[model samples]
Target: MKLDSAGLQVLSPAECVELLASTPIGRVVFTDHALPAVQPVNFVLDGTTVVMRTTPGSKLAVAARNTVVAFETDEFDPETGTGWSVTAIGYARAVTDPVETERLAHLSGAPWSPDGNDRFIVMPIRQVSGRRVRVRP
Candidate 1:
């Protein structure tokens, strides 16, 4: 097993995406009230875009107002001493087109609030990067 100065092996982009796709929950980071805010969201990888659902008054409504946002996802297996993380920086927009709304609705993200919201947001990544760490005993 090979290790870096930090004592872990680094993973490639393909590896990172593979790990990311293994899970459906990710963090959306954006500036809110002049500070960075992150929220856990349920998302699906639609080609290169990340699609999720949110309520009307949610923080996403504010963060996404700037059009640019950072989204990330990760997973790890402690028992195996391995993990990976993927981050995407992109432009986010509310999907309002009837065709897009219908298409996104078919994807798997459920509302996080009790108000039964049906709004869909799409984040189209302009740049994507990721890393993985593995500690071999």
Candidate 2:
């Protein structure tokens, strides 16, 4: 097992991608009026791209357009102190092409909230890293 300076198990790039695919929800960090903001969003991994759905005029939809964003997802077992976290950084863009949008719509079945949240925000996984808490020996 590989460990980082903080004593956490270092996860490989492939591992990180796997973890990202295993989870359904993640937090997206983006710049909001020159300040940092984070929002929990439902996402899916599409060949190394983080895909999320939001309303067309929503804050996230606006802020993430052609902007660099940080996405993160993780799971933990607090009782045993075992868990893993994955973070991916990339530029996000809204899906404007009609054909592409239609294709992505079928990726995840049923939107979490079907209230006019049909726009797709895609963030390609350009840089990713992950870490796992060291399980007790």
Candidate 3:
């Protein structure tokens, strides 16, 4: 797919959701210590939110200080020369509500972290977009 001058390719919401569900890992982008940082995170897609776990006092904790964030995931088959990427722009927050946390705990697949693994971080999606790429032979 080719991006327009603004470096964006319009994609349907359903397409974005589909891409998000197909991948178990994504990159979370945020600002930390006055600089931008990105972290690889294992996440589960919960309809409109992406959930992951991170340790306390981590860069993620500092970057997601009640601020907007970007999360992205993609799948590529180099042998088949096809792939798709999806990105979600949303607000990042810690899961503090007991009810919500309890419900999210039931989601399949747990996040892996070297730090304390009990803390959960969630990104509630506000906007999503994606694009598919096909390599020319």
Each prediction's TM-score against the native? 0.78, 0.90, 0.80
The TM-score obtained by model 1 is: 0.78
Q: Worst lDDT window (10 residues) for model 1?
A: 108-117
Residue range 18-93, candidate 3, lDDT tens digits:
8798877899988877788899977888878888766676777656757899998987787898777888999888
lDDT of each: 0.74, 0.87, 0.77
Indicate whether candidate 2 or candidate 3 has the larger TM-score. Answer: 2
Residue 132's lDDT within candidate 1 is 61
Which number leads on TM-score?
2
The digit string of per-residue lDDT tens for model 2 on 70-92 reads 99998988678799999999999
> Who is ahead in lDDT, 1 or 3?
3
Whichever of 1 and 2 has more lDDT, that candidate is: 2
Poorest stretch of ten by lDDT in candidate 3: 108-117
The order by descending lDDT is 2, 3, 1
Instruction: Output the TM-score of candidate 2.
Output: 0.90
**Model 2 CA deviation exceeding 4 Å by range:** 111-116, 134-137
Q: What is the lDDT of residue 33 in candidate 3?
A: 77
Candidate 1 ranges beyond 4 A from true positions: 1-10, 109-116, 134-137
